[model samples]
Target chain A: MSHLKHVAIAGATGAVGVEMLRCLEQRNFPVGQLTLLASARSAGKTVKFKGTDVTIKELKADSFEGVDIALFSAGGGISKEFIPHAVKAGAVVVDNSSAYRMDDSVPLVVPEINAEDVKKHKGIIANPNCTTAITLMALWPLHQAFGVKRLFASSYQAVSGTGAQAIEELERQTREWAKAERKWDDVRLPADQVKVYPHQIAFNALPHVDSFLDSGYTKEEMKMENEGRKIMHHPTLRASVTCVRVPVFRAHSVAVSAEFEKPVTVEAAYEVLRTAKGLDLVDDPTLKKYPLALDVAGKDNCAVGRLRLDCALDNGLAFWVAGDQLLKGAALNAVQIAECLV
Target chain B: MSHLKHVAIAGATGAVGVEMLRCLEQRNFPVGQLTLLASARSAGKTVKFKGTDVTIKELKADSFEGVDIALFSAGGGISKEFIPHAVKAGAVVVDNSSAYRMDDSVPLVVPEINAEDVKKHKGIIANPNCTTAITLMALWPLHQAFGVKRLFASSYQAVSGTGAQAIEELERQTREWAKAERKWDDVRLPADQVKVYPHQIAFNALPHVDSFLDSGYTKEEMKMENEGRKIMHHPTLRASVTCVRVPVFRAHSVAVSAEFEKPVTVEAAYEVLRTAKGLDLVDDPTLKKYPLALDVAGKDNCAVGRLRLDCALDNGLAFWVAGDQLLKGAALNAVQIAECLV
Candidate 1:
């Protein structure tokens, strides 16, 4: 491990990309050299890091020449095309996309849960899905205390998770709605105004998240179970998830009803959750305190709340977990993985 | 049944109350006389009914005199204090609040499924909880086919379900947010501006809906199982629910995974839901079509979509349902009960 390493951030202009830059600077990851990479359209744009402008270069086969550690936040297509080059050039890749998460050779890592998995990475470590990472921050602790059998979850995902365009879309639609000065009941937007989402997302909830799979669950919904099993090394773990895109700007919240092999009480679950690394126990219903998307946005630590015993399942528990998808879910996790390499 | 029956609407100016007036006018209920009742602050305010303005009187024990049927939408405290008065005044009351729904003598009814229960009412008939009623519109039909054993559900509830003031709160906060010209990532609302909700409802989701029970489920979350038993006549039925309040101004959506005793298929569930009274099958995942809260806001019929076999449970089916909470969940159901009385 080098004391000071050359670090390159792919998709450096994206929502997660900007946050990766901030996390590196804030955490002061011994960076001797900084390189930013994006598409041709974003190439030449300068991103500020440590009060200095770092120019984004157009990603090419030779882009990873001298970079020792590369963090990828671009879509899966870009990762698939460019990650092999990074690996070939001897740059260890930490991908924040679904491209390589389920790969047998690629280590799917959430630093807190599976930092050991990073050492076995075949030059590519995969960051878990945003919602999955946020959820497992709390679930991993509980799973350690009481073996988890299955979980039923529903996500209140933010627009920013979709990228900068969706963020702009939510803001544009909201501004359009407010500019119209429409009363509460009369709030309506035309079809032409909504683009990023299939339906109007302003003041609405879309039950669809990622593309629908043949099994009826969206590709995004299955990531919880698929990624959870890999990261937790619990092969038989089952998760049923419904992912919905909400009007929120950032931070994703998931409501989980987890059934475990052992009987779990609120106090026991809290005991495990309170001391969990990278997680905050935000329960206290009497004070109206819970992990809210509004309250969790921009924070690195994910918050868990609304812990209760499951009413239907045997030896079950219900809880809500929230976190900034860009932080623990993406950029921060990516940087932490890079830290593991050095 | 009297031809010219007098009808009084308690909580006449509330969110559901205003919708109840619309349903009564649109459905053209046999209302020979209309009496609007509210608190003292709302007294003398006139609500237009069928080209006539009816002045609201302050609610009291005497207000229900000569009223043949009264529709109550006020909170439980108001219903507890005033519903008996309406019944004593010779009026059969259809209370929308949860005050009397669980009582032994009070017949909780969703007219389509349990209008027969209305006949057994001693003096009061209770409208089911908003989420329960909307969900049952789809679940009841399927339960008949598959013999539902238990259900796990999460709700995307609207602000309108909270009452007129909540609607105002969402609107006011949204306006404040837009007026501030804050970027999506920089949206930080002040504490004092939030009134109706414990946290900011704009661009956020709250997992707490109603008061939290000792078991960790909100009182509203338990209503599905509690009210479903009485309405569906399935006393042994079980449900685990997480009720969440989203930013939507009206209409509510629920993502449900129902495990049944009998084998159920997507095609079979579709067949049953297609002809289900007050339900429309809106699923077409290939085209990205599903039941959206915005699409069902002003509609009379609830919509169910995203039908798929539950990947995690045996004989299980997953579906999404949405409806106007003010209509099918409250006002229309209450009005339907009154029609049953006549």
Candidate 2:
């Protein structure tokens, strides 16, 4: 293949898909050609990429004709349907959905933690879940320093992680309250008004994310341990995560308490995270500077802060990690994986 | 003390103080006399209680002359100063500040867990921290049933937990975005606009809740284990909590993964939590019903749901708890402690 390769993005008009375009443009991927594919509904839409308008074409099994690399971010069903067609058409795929993440043949890559795994991919490389990817950006360094055994995490996930429609849902719901001169204490929209989520997302926290499995864990909550083990090559990594959707627009933050096999100190964890790749140590508590979702909204690097010794577990460390999910969790990670290829 | 006793509220103009007034009125406490105390600036303001307007008076060292029970929601310094005067003036003081929470002479009470501890109070009682109180409402029952050993918790705490100024700050910052007719994708206030919080609370999550201690954990995060042990009488209870301040106005929600001494099943946890005092089970996942922060905003009973066997730990269970911090965590709990006196 030539250094300047042909690249196609499936679901090119969605939230993550658009960010992938930005990442490609920002990273200056040597693109001989760029193909944007979306649903028939988004077919006529044109997105600006690097001072040029790229028209989005209707996505189909035949969409990947001469593409050297296909980035899939539509959803699981779309990836499951069109990925084989892309692979059969001779394009290597980097999927951003969960459909092929746990597949043994499809290597799940986080770039920083397991870039070498990219070489093991048969055809499709899987990008991790947003919250899992953001957390591992920090936890991976600590795990390298002090072998992590198990962790308990809770996610403050943003609405944009759900898609563009979910973002509109939050804005519309909140704008409804704003339009009415209601007091802050009494700010609420009707339950019937809520569409994207099971409940309201404005000024509220919904513990339910994705669909609930039979075991009472949401599929989103289970993704951390399941995907973390695969990416970190730590089969014994245990994670109990309660994924909650907050009203934040784009970034996702995770609070994690991890127990380690080796003795860990705050200073030791600080040293490891200070030099960690794709991560920033923002842990000066006295200055009231920590990793906040708002601060990390548009950044590529996930920030780690609020480092402390876990009082509940022996040799444990607790930290908060935040990142722009559209970037590191989905697009930038997928692009980084593609960079490993070129 | 008579069945109908005199009640005085210190810091009656504050958020929890106003809620305390409402709780006393709604719970139909026999109040023969009512006195409202506040700072000198709010001394002339009047608050309505049970269809009667009570003028606020400046709280002084001599304000507790005939009060049989004094509820203190003032800051810690006020509690430390005026509480001694109130105690000397023959009033049983129920403090909402953290100043005397760990005092050997003061009995910190969460009525659901330790109503009997109220009987042990010599002259003053302490209410648990808001997040800690709401979490323990659910965790204590599980501990009673399964003998909990340790737990990891992350709190999605509300702005109202910080009091009135914070509630206004969230509304003001968000209203600025809405009034400007800004796009939702660009909704943000200037960092300087953030007043009550160290940073903007609109569409953001702050992991630093309360002051930082020498150990790197915020004072709010450590309160879970410290106050949990005192309230539940579980001396060896271990809790690693990441206390986060979210943009929600009133209710606080916590996601907890607790390790128990005995093997536990989802059915057993459901059995235990179904009939637990001051906790409502809202755990039908198939129906898309779970404990949400919005639903529990003004509710007294903390709701627990999203129950599952913790995949991370042996004999572990993960669940979520949400409640109005003002009611159960502060105002209502303090009033219940006063009710024990009558």
Candidate 3:
């Protein structure tokens, strides 16, 4: 292996894929060579990296021949089909898809919470869900202090989380509203703009995210509980989440009410969180300082605010958390795991 | 009181007040005389009701002399100042403010849940908070079937809930984005557009609503537990809520996870809610037919969907509810109380 790693990004033209490339550059990841991989349609395209253009290559089983590390941001089907081949070719995988996340052989890792788990990866490490990763960035510190048992969370997720197509869909619908000079009360999307999401997402709140399960929870909603337990190494962690797609372009914000096994005061939780890495304490309501999605759009650190004792529960704390899903939730998290590998 | 009572609307130029006038006209309340009241700035403006123009008069202490029923949509401060004058003038008041909702002498009512509480009013009947009203519309019948113990809720509130000025702010911000042809990734408001809200609400999610209380829950967030207990006659009920102001224009949506004393099945809750008054159950996920905020805007009935047994809480159920804050949350609820009185 080279002293500088050979890093490859799958689905190089996608939204998260684009961010993954930027994260590699901005974080100054050691990249002796960079391979941009996508399907035939996106192949022959060139994406600029480090002042040089890297030509995209069509991904096949032989694509990882000389690759030392593979970052997968394509959908679950693509990851499931291609990851084993990457592993067979002697490349370690950091998958952002859910295909192998729950598998015993794959270690689901959040670097701030469980960076050590990255070492436990057999051939693959899975990035936690966007909402789960952002929420746990704050919750992990609180859990370390108070031992969280369960939480109720609702997400204000971005159109970008659905990938590049959904972002364009929201933009198109919004442009349609603008072209027609529509009133705020008269918001509607022309049918063409509703292609990406199940419904129109511009200026609307969608209660559904991902596919629904027999349990009536979306695949996105249950990730907080299933992924939280795995990533936190707490087998009994429970979460009820309503994953909502809002009109925001990039950041995702979560409103969380967490119950702890031990008593928690706002000051003590603040003490634990102020020193926690990869998180910011933004909780001055008098000055109207709290986490807002727009403020955290390009930020690497997730912001936590609205810290209060939950008057509704025993040993409970309620707070708001927001982060750039493209950064902490996906690309940055995946790269941080590889940094651990190095 | 005469069979055809004199009706007066304070804050007649505001969003909820305009809706209140429409509710009276559409619901065909027996209005012998209609009195439209606003501040001195809006005085002499005429609002058409029942195909007749009613001139706006400045709201003063002596304005309610001949009024038999007064509906107030003004802020809490205004409500507190003028409610006594209205009551002392022999006008039964239905106030849509927080000024007296918690006052022991006033009856806080959601007509479907507690119409009988209307008869127990001592001169004034108070309306529940908009988000609370919309949530309880779905939770009330289920509470009848399952006996709710506590709830955790997150709200996607509309700008109109903050009154006319907020609606204009969102519209202005959106128009600014359109005027500048700003990209979705470059969302920011000029300092002027940030007048109504503490921050830019367009393409963003604000976690602050109403004012911050000492416990860190906004006044709007705590309204669910406080008002739900009064309306449902469940004094021991506890609620933890995160009230978020989204860029939505009209409807407010709530995602609630409620624990009940008796075990709940989706079918049982459906059976109760389908037959309940002023609610429509929209929960078939296969067709992608859960409730969306856009689907409920301008509608009188609140829609409940996304039903499933909660996996996070014992004997808990989770659901999503959407309703127009103007109709079911405020105006229609106030008019319904008047109907009960008649």
Candidate 4:
């Protein structure tokens, strides 16, 4: 444990970067030194680390020289450009971007599901999509219990997954509506109101999450099918997903109906989830207790509930899963990968 | 059209009641006269009708006198107590509550799916749940072409379905959050801090929409399976639903995977939905267009998109549907029943 390592976090001023700092503090990770790096726009900004202020430096190709670990969440373009440079600097990079997740050379790892996959990483490890990570958190436990064949899933994804700008957009539009209704007198818009999204997201749900692919599925929607196979080591696994952006600020929730090759029961699922790591069971429907975003917003483990047998398909189970998108989806997953390396 | 019937509306100040008024105006329903009724607390309130103010009368056993059509949406307790009275007063009742949906004598109608069921109504007709109605709007069309067998659905329900108060609750909480984060010091909390829900709704997604049942499903979740079978006239038709409450002010979206006896294809679904009344096709993924709550907020027709083959099930097709819960789910459906009678 005393063999601590220095960590450098790219996009240190961004939402996932903030979560990375919190995760390090929460997990008591062996952080010999911390380097906070951001873009030129965020350079010189100070961030608090364990009650001490750390000034952010502009990220460059040479910034990772002394850093043993590099966590990147500054979007795909930034990660694509800087990841190679960091890896060349001899740092093990855990990237929270889709740029390299599907790259054959990069291993996508969800530590709880496939930690051994980390050993195959070619300097850079990819974090699975928030929806994929949250869904697999519940599905993996069941997949181990019953051989999963296919899945039909719909995600109620939080706006935070889109980044900090989208979160501000939701809050800003919601306040605008409230003020317009004469429900309150105070009305103020955020100074930077560049529509990060196509539509106003304050009090609405958008079906188009990310850019649409040639297969007619949004980038976010195809992630479960594409990333799930890689993380679960199931090359032939099938999934159809509808990823939706909801007004939620934090946690992402997924409703899944999984079909397995073998028989599965609600009782068996409950038993499996109870002892599973990175999972919590809040599925007592009779008591009005189930996995909700509000309860799972700040938590590390994904909350799964509403588990029942699917009446429509044989050997199918229907369940609802929720987890903090910023945590399991991005920051915590990257940190967990770093932990595995240590 | 000269024989336009006299109409009465109970729960005239509620969320659905407001939509009922708008739907009647938009569709130009033939009405000899309009009677607005509400509980004692709101009896004297005035609501707009045909650009004129109509006073709300106290709803009682004799309040439906001389009325030929009555639309009830004042919760199940009020509907149960007043529906018989309205029936005895020579009025045909269309209820938007769960009070009589499963009753043997009551006919549940989704005008597009089973308008013929309206003729079977013995004085009272039941409206399907908002989520159930929005789901079937697109499904029934596909079901006709494919001979539907079963469905797995998850609803992204709006706060308005909970009533006017819940909408107010979402607005209030949002404002509270904005004021607390006084980036703009001008924001202040509204004087009336009334709570319509048990929890803060803004920036959060509540998995529990309605009251939980003994069978581990919310009352809202079971509505699809119970009311759907009744409305579809398929006593054995199966549905598994997970109803979620989102922060949208209007329009409920549902992701559905339906399995039919016959083969299903995206092309065939496109054809079925294109010609289907009460459904608008919004499924072009290339343009990043799909059914969204913001787009369907004030629309009568349910917007259907994300059409594809369900990879998990045999003969299964997956799609996403969004519709204004206030309109098709409540107001428009009720008004359509009146149109059928005319």
Worst 10 residues of 2 chain A by lDDT: A184-193
DockQ of each: 0.83, 0.86, 0.83, 0.51
lDDT, each prediction = 0.92, 0.92, 0.93, 0.84
Model 1 chain A poorest 10 in a row by lDDT: A182-191
Of candidates 4 and 3, the better by lDDT: 3
Can you give the lDDT of residue A35 in candidate 3? 92
Q: Candidate 3: DockQ?
A: 0.83
Q: Which digits, one per residue and each the tens of the lDDT, describe model 2 over residues A22-102?
A: 999999998899999999999988889889988999999899999999999999999999999999999999999999999
Which CAPRI quality tier does the interface of model 1 achieve? Answer: high
lDDT of 1 by residue, B1-342 (tens): 479889999999888898889988999999999999999999999889999989999999899889999999989999999998999989999999999999999999998898888889988999999999999999999999999999999999999899988998888888998999988987768887799988888989999899988887899999999999989999999899999999998899999989999998999999999999999999998998899998898999999998989877889998899999999988999999989998
Task: Put down candidate 2 lDDT per residue, B1-342, tens digits, no spaces.
Answer: 878989999999999999999999999999999999999999988889889888999999999999999999988999989999999999999999999999988899988788888888889999889999999889988999999999999999999889899998988888888888888668668767878888889899999888999998989999999988988888999999999999899999999999999999999898989999889999999998999888998888999999999998899999999999889989988998888888
Higher-TM-score candidate of 2 and 4: 2
lDDT of 1 by residue, A1-342 (tens): 468999999999999999999999999999999989999999988878999988999988899998999999989999999999999999999999999999999999998999999989889999989999999999999999999999989999999899999999999999999999887777679889988888888988899998999888999999999999999999999889999999999899998889999989999999999999999999899999999998888888999999988888989998999999889888999999888888
Candidate 4 docking classification: medium
What is the C-alpha lDDT profile of model 3 across B1-342, one tens digit per residue? 889989999999999999999899999999999888999999999989988888999999999999999999999999999999999999999999999999998999988888888988889999889999999999999999999999999999999899999998988888788778888788887787799899999999999999999999999999999999989999999999999999898999999999999988888988999998999999999999988889998899999999999988999999999999888988889999888888
Ranking according to lDDT, highest score first = 3, 2, 1, 4
Docking model 3 quality class = high
Output the chain A TM-score of model 2.
0.99
